[model samples]
Target: MFIDRLDAGTKLAQALKDHPLVQKIALADRLVLSIPRGGVVIGKKISIQLNSRHDVILVKKLGAPFQSELAIGAIAETGQPFIDQSLVNQIRVDDSYLREEINRVRAKIAMYKTKFRQDKELNLAAHLTILVDDGMATGETMKAAIAWLQGQEKTHSKTYHLSPTTYLIVVPVAASNAATDIRALGVELVCLEESSDLTAIGQFYERFDQVTDEEVIKLLAKN
Candidate 1:
């Protein structure tokens, strides 16, 4: 288990370096997108190790109507939702509920975008983009983030030249099922620990603390 975010970040950096793609691409052509605010901690360490660019992607979970913390899906900055159809059917979610949640999370994503990326936009064209997070639960949030990136990839590839290398996702820990789901995106996924019976992300860490927006702002400033 990791002692904290820094420790996790350090170990994750080493794992990323050991990947086969590390020798295939130039460091200048790589970019690391962190799912803040905890992921930024890991991203910072990775950027330093690989000498790659680092930025934030604002994606959030689309929580269930009754239980605000239970994620039925997730939404990205693009205002699109990635829903779990099986879960939706089992819970009998209506179209209206999905619409409301999509807009709600989109608004939150906008707020975070304005607060975090006030100066510039993330440029994924012609670069090997790596999405980093502290860990995953249902993997809804990360899935939405990847879907959003894939949307950009499809749109921008028609106009600009994209790299031939595959995209990547790295995390300190993740659920085994979620890891498989993430790999289904056709990206190289690197998780330090893929637990079969995962409960909480914090369960694998010795000191998992709250990462605030202010802290994320400061951390990004350093990079």
Candidate 2:
């Protein structure tokens, strides 16, 4: 367990130093996209360590109706989103409700993108993309984020105008099942821990405070 996000970030960076990706590609050829708000903290550290450009990925979870804590899928503001078909069926969600949820989530994503980011977007065709999050539970949000980088409508605040070539996922910890799901995405994942006993992500940390928007803006400014 880590003392805080900074401690987790340090450990993650140390573990990544010997990775073949770092050894093969020059750091200048990488771009990191962080899933805010906790993710930006770790992403900034990894970006600095890899000497890569960093940006934010604006994504929101599409929670199942009547149980908003349960995530059925996730959506990106300006690109294709992803949903778990099995979950949708299990929840007995109608097509009309699903469509409505997608629209609602997309609007929220757009607001976050506008509020947190500006005129810039990651041009994925040029550099190896890296998506960083604090950790993973269901992995739905991260999956949608990956799709955002690779899917159609590769545009953002402006037209991003590119397609994904190669990408990586980085995180401090994830549920054992979540790690498996992430691996199925066909992207390399660098995680500090994948534990079957992971009841919650905060359980693996000593000081897991909420990362505020103010903190994200400050870190991005420094980067």
lDDT of each: 0.83, 0.80
TM-scores, each model vs. reference: 0.91, 0.87
State in Å the error of residue 48, model 1.
Answer: 1.2
True-vs-predicted CA distance for residue 27, candidate 2, Å: 2.3
Instruction: Please write out the lDDT profile of model 1 over residues 46-164, one tens digit for every residue.
Output: 88888888899888888876977667998887677789888888888899999988888888888888778883677665457778999997788888887777777778878534432
Q: What is the lDDT of residue 22 in candidate 2?
A: 68
Clashing pairs in 2: none
Model 2 scores worst on lDDT over the 10 consecutive residues at 156-165
- Best candidate according to lDDT: 1
List where candidate 1 sits over 4 angstroms from the true fold.
158-165
RMSD of each candidate relative to the true structure:
1.9, 3.2
